[model samples]
Target: MTAHDTATAARVRALVAEELPRLVGIRRDLHMHPEIGYEEYRTSQVVVRELSDAGVAYAAGLAGGTGVLAHLPGEGARAVALRADMDALPIVERSGREWASRTPGRMHACGHDGHTAILIGTARVLARLAAERTLPHPITLVFQPAEEGGGGGKRMVDEGALDGRHFGPPVDRAFALHGWPDLPLGEVGTRRGAMMAASDRFEVHVSGTGAHAAWPHRSADPVVCAAAIVTALQSIVARNVDPLDAAVVSVTVMQAGEAMNVIPDRALLRGTYRSLSEETRSMLERRMTEVAEGVARAHGCTARCECIRGYPVTVNDDGAVAQFEQVARATLGDARVRTIAAPVMGGEDFAFFGPHASACYWALGLARPGIGCPALHAPDFDFADEALPTGVELMCRLALA
Candidate 1:
């Protein structure tokens, strides 16, 4: 690194160290009071308060009344945007931490608490740099709501969160990060192509005649038909989709008979399908409906399939990925950056930013050596406090890049 660059990196680190204490407090506060999608009122307040204290400009009460957009002005023509999700999952906290979620059936199991804290730190540090006039371009801060299936990222883009309507300039490129449990702490990872799968949900309703459990010939059992439909649905991935391609069809919810002895007149089946490519996604939807209907007909029942499209495939722009690698290595050191081996099957609403700007989403490592962390969305999962400084430093340097 050049002398100027080295000095700048050092300054950023020192600033992060200065801010860590308060940021950690804010993160713990968020963890203790978790909120679900479109309901992050308290979390939204924390973000706005932090931005206000830093003298950063922002707009609140957005994206279903919980989104916040903060900005920093610069000399560049178009702004660069950074984002963090502000929603928690619906799982009960079982992490056993002293600061575990106080609200029952809600927790920040996805490390969104950490992401929000890092972005807050980034805003604070960069606001200081902007005061010193060291900024290279306009920076956008997007605190989005409802990332856990509420389409808050899409809502933010639709509401002009990145278009500079409330900020410095129209955003040209965007970046986001998620805390990853598999990678060792202090590392950051990304790839040039697809980073996450496109998620789609399905519900199947099967209609059949009700009958007594003891009378086999007296009824057309809907439960049996629903089970058959579920079994045949698996073939959509195993037999229909190409082995080279990746697809998932899971029947997660099933409801039919309530009584032990009586067969219900109808059955309901709900599940999700995920694919990495649009072609595969389209095919999965088509074949899923076809399989359910085809299987139900042969079982003396009628079926209706409803497919709901969720988040699109998260694709990383080549140029954005390159810039992320460069800035991450420069800020965190060369060995701390990793090129991920493959795209994960999970879904991310951050994919919503792809159409508006050159967007890149990466992973922040959170696991300790020889001790694996809890999987995301698990009851025991919690954000790693020790990794906060690394996340903050990367985001701060990315803003200056």
Candidate 2:
């Protein structure tokens, strides 16, 4: 690296250290006051206030009224987009932290608060660099809502978040980060191909004849049939999908009857299926429907399988991944930058931005397992505040890279 580059990085590190405390405070405030997808009014306001304070221009009230896009201009049209979801989960907080969610039945279980604070901190650092005329490219900060299950990234893309229509220059590449409980603190990692699976939900309804509890031969029990279908759904992934390929068919919710004494006329099953490729995704959907209906027919009951497609597979661009690794290795030592071996099964709506721009989603190390840090979506999971400086400095470096 050039002497000037080394000096600039030193400045960024110092700036990150300076911003850590305020960023942690922002993250905690967001955690305490949480909002669900498409309803991040207060979260959006916080982003707007921070950008305004930094003298950065932005366009707000986007994507069903809770998305914010901020810009830090540079010389050319080339730009890099940094994204952070602003929505919280419906789960109640159980993390015992002082800043636990104040809103009932709502919490930042997936570390979006940390992500937002990191981006806000990145914007702050970039703003300082831009003022000193040392930053390279224009930056677009995307504070999107509804990433849990709401496809907020798709909403942002549709509304021209990267098209330069609303604000900033047309985006050339996009990057997003998530706090990963699996990785040790101070490390970061991502894969080259698919980073996250495509998320889709399904509901299987079985209908049969109701009968009195006293009679064994009087009931066409849909409950029994639903049980068999659940067992059969696993075989689709086990026996049908290629052994080298990955797919999941989970029956997470099941409802039979209200009373134990009488057999009900109907039963309901609901859950999600995920895949890393479109071809595998289509095959899973098709086979699931066929299996559910065929199994129900064998049981002399009618069945309906409804599938709701969510986000697509999150694929990383080769160039973007390489750039990220290079910059990250320089910022953090080579030992801190890792190449993930496989794609994770979790789904991220950030996959929506892949087709529109060269996008790469990465994992920020939070804490080790068996520690206080819990898996995402769990009520006990809280974002590690100590990782703020690392996240902030890396994001700033990626944008300037």
Candidate 3:
């Protein structure tokens, strides 16, 4: 590294160290009270209050929901944006930490609390740098809600979160990070293309004549048809898609008769299909519908399928990926920065920003050696406190770089 870069990295580490305690406290507070989707009122309030305290300029009540936008001082025509999701899952908390989820059935199992705190910390550091007039370009902080499944990122874009037409200067580049439970703390992961899959939800409704439990050929059974449909759905991936293509077809939810003796007239099946490429995504949707109807027809039942198009596959800009690698390597030694081996099947709404601006969504390690951390979405999951400073430093350096 050059002498100037080395000095800057040292300076950033010191600043992040100074802010770590307060930021950790804030992160724990958020962990104690978790909110879901657009209901991140308290979380938004905390962000606004912190931003105000940090002397950062911001506007709340954005995105037609619980979203906040903050801007840092700089001198450039182009602006860079950073994102942090502020929502929790509906799982009951099982983590035995002192600052576990206070809200009964909601928890920050995905480490969004840490992400929010890290972004806030980054803002604090950049605000200080802006005071010293070291910022290269204006920075945009996006406190987005409903990233769990409600597509808050898309909502923010729809509400003009990225479009400079209404909010501020048009965002030229964007970035965000998700906590990774498998990797060790103080490490980061990044990839160039298709970092995550496109998630689409589907429902199959099967209808048939009700039949008595004792009767066999007296009436048509929708339960039988639904079971056959579920079994056949698996072939959509194994048989239809190319062997090299990545795809998953899971029938997560199924509903049928309520009584023990009588077969219901209709059955409802719900599940999600994920693919890393758009062609495979389309192929899965079409084949799933065709398979459902075709299988039900063979059983003397009629079936209809409904597919809800969700966020597209998350594709990272090559240039943004290179920049993130440099920033992460400089901020936290080169050994800590890693290129992911494969794309995760999970879904991310950050894909929305890729089309609007250059965007890169990376992962922050939350695990500790020997003391294996709980995987994300697990009830007992908690954000690692020790990783907070690393997250803060990486974000600050990325903004400055």
Worst 10 residues of 2 by lDDT: 366-375
The residue-by-residue lDDT of candidate 2 on 80-198, one tens digit each, is: 99999999999989999999999999999999999999999999889988888756788889999999988999999999999998766799899999998888889999889899999
Per residue, candidate 1 scores C-alpha lDDT tens digits across 32-70 of 999999999999999999999999999999999999999
Q: What is the number of backbone collisions in each predicted candidate, taken in the order shown?
A: 0, 0, 0
Give Cα distance to truth, residue 49, candidate 2, Å. Answer: 0.9
Displacement of residue 264 (Cα, Å) in model 2 is: 2.8
Error of 2 at 279 (Å): 0.9
RMSD for all candidates, in order, please: 1.6, 1.9, 1.5
Candidate 2 residue 61 C-alpha distance from true site, Å: 0.5
Model 3 lDDT, residue 64, Cα: 56
Measured with C-alpha atoms, the lDDT of residue 360 in candidate 1 is 93
Per-residue lDDT for 397 in model 3?
Answer: 84
Tens digit per residue, CA lDDT, model 3, 95-210: 99999998999999999999999999999988876776557777888899999889998988887777775445788999999999888988999999999999989999999988
Lowest lDDT 10-mer window, candidate 1? 128-137
Pick by TM-score: 1 or 2, better one: 1
Clashes, model 2 = 0
Please report the TM-score between candidate 1 and the true structure: 0.96
